[model samples]
Target: MRKLLLRSFYRIYQSVFKMAMPFLPWRRPVLLEGAGSIKKLPGLLEELKIKNVLIVTDSTLMKLGLLDNLIKELGINGCKYAIYDQTVPDPTIENVEEALKLYHKHNCKAIIAFGGGSPMDCAKIVGARVSRPKMPIEKMKGVLKVIFKIPTLIAVPTTAGTGSEVTLAAVISNSVTHEKYPINDFCLIPHYAVHDPELTLKLPSHITSMTGMDAMTHAVEAYIGRSNTKETKKAALEAIALIHQNLLKAYTTPGDIQARAAMLKASYLAGVAFTRAYVGYVHAIAHTIGGFYGIPHGLANAIIMPHVLEYYGSAANGKLAELADHLGIGKGSQSTDQKANAFIQYLKEMNQKMNIQSNIEQIEEKDMPEMISRALAEANPLYPVPRVLFEEELKELYYKIKG
Candidate 1:
């Protein structure tokens, strides 16, 4: 008992010491939330002296009549913009090249990425490429390729997830090789993100469930990440609470504007949390599944979340206990270990309620070795993950989660 108590106190001291160190960096929009923020678009355009803008999105949103609504808003504000709504599930280099072509064709002075991460990522790349036509996308892979000032870029997320609007990192794929590249730069981050929950009310139930779970994963991972700090912990906790309260309401009733708005707020907070603190094995594994199977990014995150949390619980116990208390898990007598497992149990129960599957359809054990390799390849260096795994260990975890 003494040893355990001493270890917990030591861990607490280490966390406090890390918090005192001024290493973790924070970044985001000056202001966030609500419906009428979209009204600020014209002023932003005017500020940038942008007369022409290119909007990048996907066809599903276009067919849903959301595109026409946004067009109406832009017209009311007298913002000149053109639409190139061809962004696909896993946005590719080909998509970036094509969007760049359209940007130059229209003499677009700025870019507005509407929809989820795919469109936002494409727009970031488009913004970068328009400024540097000679620089190959491959050459622009690492940090800070967009050195000089380029076109003004704004992100308007229609979904209550992805949080691509505020993140400095954007992901694009090499289709032929089936590999995803993450581009990190201060310049790629959007100048504005109009997170109107009203926009998300139109999302289907499955989408709402998957995306909400994704936001929840973001908050959880950020709270326990190696790069965590005080501000990030606060953001992650509040975001988790919001998701716990609002996700079910939004999932069952897609037209619930209040629930939709709360979800949007949660996603934005999660973005802020993860932007500085980063993610862990959940994201690392999800990225691999997304690149390989073309699974919706959010669904992949949702499916892998509980499994990864179980693996990391030994390291993340105190944080997980705090998270459980926030979720109202204890009845005043439960130990921290019980609370920690309760949080994992809560997630498992929630996944079942949401109909999230444990098994990836048609992905076999024979493929485990390669999947583990890809997951590790993507996860280790970029992410400030809490726990590190070797190849065999990662492979074992993959099969364990595969069950």
Candidate 2:
């Protein structure tokens, strides 16, 4: 009886501790930036004693001449680097294999990911694959499975969203299965992350809006998530403020560097927050839709965020109210329920402002059941979500997003 009671008490203690851990300890190496900071990449590499580096990115960014600037900067610093510019949005297992080949062939001691989430994710896989050649990337799909320490990595973000820089999670799609698998390991977080706003100046308005919404979703989910701690809450609050203030400005005027910078910083902070606190149903549902329909991840979240928050409101009322006040809505609410509704309205209003549209046709009604199955399977294991979801409820949420 004594032993059984002790075990039960330990379980309870761990459960509560997960809920209450304050300012949850998070660690990432130095972040350096400015318009000219990309020029400093060479010196950072030298300081780390890295000789050869592999640059991981995509063709679009390369076509935009972004990689050329990086190459010039590296040349000025006398750095040796090779380009692996085949990263695609929602990178596939085949993409990882090819990048891994380049990683080994070039004998790269370090890796630089220079696009959005895809490049960063591909870089993470490269690091893992290079560390252990015989270990299949498929086996490293779950959290903390990449046991080997990876090569030194640096990430430079060209988009204001995704926040892949600070995140330990990487999303890779399996072409054969058409499933997006997340590799979650703290070992994958980059050694240095640079958020250069200047790099985002050329981003189109639609992409800016979608990415900024992604950042906002990160803040909202982090704040109300089951994993919310004092530290994560602080990070979430700051991210919310920055994203709220600057996303619209950035969207309306894509060339506004100052606004772009604010969104970039907000996305980075949101990444930092969610990296430790984890995300909730918004991401859970978004990832499913993204994989099944090839919908942009950020846009999917933007459309579905209001519905997900509504479901979460019952269990996460107080936190939602706090977010309302942060967004300057419903200060003198009649009750927590009222405040939560108002908060949801604010989200809807923001979506309208951003011109995000959703239709049921976008997500086939016939496929709702299967999407829920996959989403639940992917989400429940990691997210400290406020409430457990049933198949019917998830289907309802899907319909709501479609509407």
Candidate 3:
């Protein structure tokens, strides 16, 4: 009865949300592939007549000089810029508030979110906060909570994950309370995304492996979620194909431009798919884990994804079989359950290839109850999970990962 009620609520919420999605303004222009594209950004900004811009990034990226090249471009183009490079791994509300102060102090007219998901998420919140100064950031957590956008926001991702460059959602953390908040609104999407593969070549192999799996999780969850549309399936299929063929190559040979480019495209497609189709318990639990334990977003997703899908069992079997077929791992002679099993095995192998560990010593037995509660709170209405997860099942899931 509880599962039925949860499913009913999820379906209704998704139906209403999807009906509204088509009408939402999606105006972001994506620069598909400008090889060696960092140089082109300054020219693009100048052409748009953007003068003062705020670059929100992390200190590591700034030190690596991944962000410095873009700043050099801005300098050469004569665009005045201010940088808030204090963005942490999971950006906090206090972090964003500080960034907002920096933004206002510079009298900035535009935003350039120039790192991985952290900076991008921070930029979105900062942009929304700047436009709707009186609105509480917490109020923007639900669907369509944001009504206005500020300045010309452009996303230039230093890493090939998160798809924050193209998505309409941002996840920010509450520093004091340690809860993660996801803000969803079409208006929160960036004005443009500079998908330059050059910027990601220097990324470490572990990061490449983890972020690639993060993209895969997005595509898989989007494909199997209750709210999937034809469009989302198409995008998800493309993303999965790209990841299956290129993710390993990219992980092994970090400097392979072609592989990195394919990975970027996969991430972008997965982002588009998940934003429309929504994600499931994998993301819900992963977000909660990151909030509570500070696990890297991609690593958490990679860890939780297989277990969640297995828990869903027959509910997600057909979709999983389809994915197995895409990877050419399933023969049509077998039952879909068998194909699904095959698919899960492939996922385990894929993780092994990327050196992803299956167990975490950090998750304690005591944290299981609260984690389950928070996971449900985040997923019950907003995410279209295939199976209605129960508290007992989540506890079991945690035990599996904890071991």
Measured by lDDT, the strongest candidate is 3
By TM-score: ranked, best first: 3, 2, 1
Any idea how many clashes model 3 has?
0
- lDDT tens per residue, model 2, 133-248: 78887888767788678899899998988888988889888877667768888788888988778889888888898888898888888888766667778889999999888988
On TM-score, who's better, 1 or 3?
A: 3
Q: On a 0 to 100 scale, what is the lDDT of residue 337 in model 1?
A: 74
lDDT of 3 by residue, 1-403 (tens): 8778876877798778778767768755557375678778888888889888999999988888887778788898899999999999989988789989988898998899998899999999999999889998988886788877677889988777788888888999988877886888888889888888888898989889888999999999999987788888999999999999999999999888999999999999999999888898899889888888899999999888888888899999999999999989999898999999999888888898889987666887777777888888888777877877778888888887777
Q: Give the TM-score of candidate 1.
A: 0.89
C-alpha TM-scores of all predictions: 0.89, 0.92, 0.96
Candidate 1: lDDT of 290?
A: 79
Displacement of residue 277 (Cα, Å) in model 2 is 1.0
- Per-residue CA lDDT of model 1 for 142-240, tens digit only, reads 566766555878888887777777777788878886666677677777877787777787888888888888898889998987778788899899899
Model 3 stretches with alpha carbons more than 4 Å out: 1-3
